[model samples]
Target: MRLAFIGLFFLCTTIYAKQPAVTPHGVETPGVQTLPYVIDGNVKVFHLIAEPVEKVIYNGKINLLEEFVKKNNRYSGPTMKLPVEIQKIDGWGYNGNIPGPTIIVNQGDFVRFHVSNHLPEPTTVHWHGMIVPNDQDGTGGTADPVIMPGKTAVYEFQIVNEPGTYMYHSGFNDTKQALKGLDGFLLVLPKDGVDLASSDFAIMLQDWAIPEGSEQIKYLSMDRNWFTYNGLAAPNFPVLVVDEGERVRIRFGNLGLMSHPIHLHGYSFKITGTEGGPIQESAQWPAATVVIAPGETRDIEFIANNPGLWRLHCHVLHHILNDTSYFAQHQKNGIFPEGGLWTYLYVKPAKDQMTRASE
Candidate 1:
């Protein structure tokens, strides 16, 4: 009887010892299951081998010109000018345009951004999607220091992530600064140069509002009554010129408060890539309208097989108007042709393109 009791006690104690300990949040088991949240010691570890920054060419260099400008005398707009040239837009933008300069770089290339702030307040540039080193990140207090008024700062990082569409914007006082139109894009082209075409383009959709004829944007108002593509509303929106039968790539990005379902008339395009990187060919699908949400970028490609002046605009009815400029009666039947974020794609005939090519 004494031996039987001793054996039974030992068996119960052994069984209890094998049971896992339950904590409020996790379970602590034995061996590989010691900690539910902890990484297994026996798991294989892999390191990402990147090119040395010093040995690679820092080919893409940009100078950010962040400032407040008075356009049309009464309208106030924020702008960013890169190198004071390359491209310039009147709408609130970096380097003097809305949707700032598209920083294009080959995969594995190094990039250097020299930011100069001419705004009334301090600011910093945050690489929106790329994995930059903590110190190079422009998060102001937590990462790099801010660029004070009339001061400059530099941010350097390598393109180690997969080739895709990313973005950059004011990180300091983001609520006010970014809302005031201080943002742009970063395009990483694959080194192999797959799907390279002459018709590649980039467009950024943004919203704005000023009191009727006021030249300055309503910085405090959430109701952005004005809409634009690269800073100009429709009737003034730039036309995308392409040739018939040519493969065209349009890179679309949105930094506004609303998502835009951009409808491309007469063509079903494939979303080839996004901020996350190029989607595999087998996984790509076709759509007539691609939706771009806030802080997101998408790349779509299609062959311009049909030749004509095709309308490209946001499908949302309200996105087709600028403030109270349009009357309910005027748009009761269809969208007013002279307002909103609409643009045209002038797909010329093959013969026309050839004739113009020689000139």
Candidate 2:
């Protein structure tokens, strides 16, 4: 008993002795600053600095316009041997993020799009499913002229359709342009406003094929090696976070060659609408899975009642796996990896989880 007590005393002495003598780097002694000292004699100190934030303000006008440049973009992943260059890509969308940005506007606002062609060929931005004037239809050879290389043009149109999900993509070379990862989703809200939901998300799915050790995508190969949501495969994709008991609206769009049967593991949702318009409340239907075909878009809403990590992915087996060769290489050795058209839907306990994280 005495030895044990002596040992406890020594342990306490050692812990206290290891405490770091923290001092403020740019302030007076002990001025509201301290370092965290761990048992292994490690000290962690942090400095406080204020940084400026760039703010974008909107005021119900269609004055907002974005630039889209077509170029080659490099795509890489943990499964690939080297980064593959994707031809017919976007400078703003590919550089900033895949599938471009989420364009949100009121039902009656006038929106304009500034498009610039930088690729070897000509291209145009088609407001897919949008009822624009014939001149602003963006059909390249038909509705409008192609935005040639090093040339820029603008398409301005007023939103006349009902509030719902919509899609935008390259309409120049049809399959060739759209298949090169040139597509995005646009959201139109009711003029008054929408019901305050827990959160909202826009997910765009696409597929790509690139040969091993190659830089450019194989435009003709049907064996696509990479499937992505917003240009990121599983494990690399950001988690879709929401609070338990909160309602969520997920807008889905597919601009690839094939269709995708998207499945959500934990909850069923109502098909709220599509790119055409909002589905009437009486016409809405509940579904645990929905199929999005090429050039299609779907809007789904659900209450996150489950509090856990759930899987959201394409039901197609090959789409859920990264590459065909990778799958074959592993199948021969009995090793199948997880990642591809999959991501986690994280449901937290409370709304504070969202607020605390945003702050």
Candidate 3:
């Protein structure tokens, strides 16, 4: 316990007053902030200071994977390296955290965030799902890297747009970081507001790799070859619970660039929304799982039907492993032809495990 407290204290002290520029004579940078939830309340803000990152990928020289290798270096890409923070043994995983944090927001509101660069280079944020300006679009040049180290840039925009499941990530090197863990889920509630009592819930599915005994956190390595749902692999699956007889909505958002045919072992939900945002009518589809593509969003709703412990995961079993090779090496391995788990739906419904409590 003492060690945990000490670690937390050190992290707070460093980040609280962390000046840009990662190293001496480096680019002095500011801090990054973010807005947790965009409710109807007064303006609220949050922050995230991104520093330059470098990572290493150890590719396996076995099987078909070797065919994808480039000149002794199995891994070949524009940038396989990324800045990574080691785990502090308290909530902090190698790459900072798991499932990251739940991003909250509501319909008809405004959100302003100042993304500061602590790294020696440059970076920016892109509001993945929500509609914003070409500038607040949060990308490189399209918006702008909030200045380099030592400086700060703020992204201001009205959340005056569609809501549902959305995403936000480093638009600077989106093709890379965004695919990694640099992204989080965003929820835009309705005008009347969101109802936690019986209405909304969210789940973000991602697969990451943190090489054992290394300060570097590689989002995904084709070689490490481990997969997880919301960062959890099978057997380590999370149990989602709710009132047995109540109506419930499961908001599944796919932040990974790969498509996930998420199957619910038991309950079937209504495909109520898509990446384009919420569907107008209750145009419903009854299925155990739904196909969700990256940079895309989907919302599913269903009454607490045959409730029991259910498994909600990407139909891509390999992804159920690590998302590494599923995306990094073989694009074909990433594709789902003729509506497989990557296209169609799968369900394994059972009875509720919780006893009916007498009121």
Candidate 4:
């Protein structure tokens, strides 16, 4: 009897020890924000307002040109004074933010959106890549009615599709309104409520055709000069921090005019999913860069085995810098300073190493 009791104790201890640590399941949009929702009965309710907002692409505190000049004294050029406002634009956004706030939900969940139009013109919210009723599609032509300025529209739908990355943008005058910044990410998690990744991030890519020395966004122009991730250009975007050996997932959405080949340094990842749905394991392939075209979303996952700061940026050379003409004039040997659609992934040491270091 004593032996049996000891054996049972050992089994229970082993079982409890093998249990994995509980990590919260949710998506994080660095440099952007998330929309809050309230639960009414079985439905989740979200409120959004489309309005004209002044967006700051760069805080202008980090003068890359000045740094370059200080590093290379041989180059003689005019250095921009510190604390100059880099790029600010008058654009349209939902809930007071360009690219708006991310809306996260689960498969099989019923959701309602109360979208109010505060802009000077009418608009509608179209759920990109979502399967919903015809009338609730927000097409704004013969289908859903447009939400006129100063009016509100209600859209309710049950998510019947698989878990994946999706987006929402303006339906009426889409090219003009969306280009001015009326778009956002819509992420749907699994219904089982099990998110395997230790860190899940959502990033939205956008570009603007703003001329130098101007704060207005030229929505009709196709020549984009400013590029951003989550409404922020590089050097201003927040770092994505995670522990070494942890699984990391990043969802990329592009509503811009051009495609961006987003690349990650120091590690290779698998294209696990897209805006449509998760790719089968057999269909998944290893890639260091993934091209996200307009109206598309790609989800990539990797294990953070290396403990270091890794660069994650758009490979399009022109898209990596802000104020093209300004940087072009100060270019050294044809190399420009980094600025747009760029950020770092900071991987900390493993938990065991941290514990040992403390001792």
Q: At residue 293, what lDDT does model 2 achieve?
A: 92
> How well does candidate 3 score on lDDT at residue 255?
62
Q: Write the per-residue lDDT of candidate 2 for residues 96-159, one digit (tens) a residue.
A: 3346555565687766566666556777888887889998988989978987876777777788
List candidate 3 segments past 4 Å from native.
1-42, 51-100, 194-199, 209-224, 234-237, 322-359
lDDT of every model, 2 decimals = 0.62, 0.63, 0.51, 0.85
Query: TM-score rank, highest first?
Result: 4, 2, 1, 3
lDDT of 4 by residue, 1-359 (tens): 99999999999999976865433656898767889999999999999999998999898775322321224443456544322366898999988899899998999999999999999999999999999999998899769899988999999999987888999999999989999999999999888767778789999999988877888898888778889989998777877778888899999999989899999999989999988989999999999999999999999999999876678899988898786655555543454546888887777777554531222
Instruction: Evaluate residue 5 in candidate 1 and report its C-alpha lDDT on the 0 to 100 scale.
Output: 100
Q: Write the per-residue lDDT of candidate 3 for residues 1-359, one digit (tens) a residue.
A: 99999999999989965643221211100011223434336654655555543321212211221222235543344432212122211111112434444556667666666666664446676777677877677667654544566666777776776766776777766555555556666666665653422534565665444554443446445443444344434333324445555556666666655667888766656788775787766566688878877677788777665644344556766654323443444454333211111111111133423342111
TM-score of model 2 relative to the true fold?
A: 0.71
Q: Could you tell me which 10 consecutive residues in candidate 2 have the lowest summed lDDT?
A: 24-33
User: So what's the TM-score on candidate 3?
Assistant: 0.62
How many collisions between residues are there in candidate 1? 12
Indicate whether candidate 1 or candidate 4 has the larger TM-score.
4
lDDT of 4: 0.85
Per-residue lDDT of model 1, residues 232-296, tens digit only: 56545556778898778887778777788999998999998887777899999999999999888
Candidate 1 Cα RMSD after full superposition onto the native fold (Å): 22.1
How accurate locally is residue 4 in candidate 2, as Cα lDDT from 0 to 100?
100
User: Which stretches of model 4 miss by more than 4 angstroms?
Assistant: 1-25, 62-84, 328-335, 351-359
Model 4 Cα displacement at 77 (Å)?
12
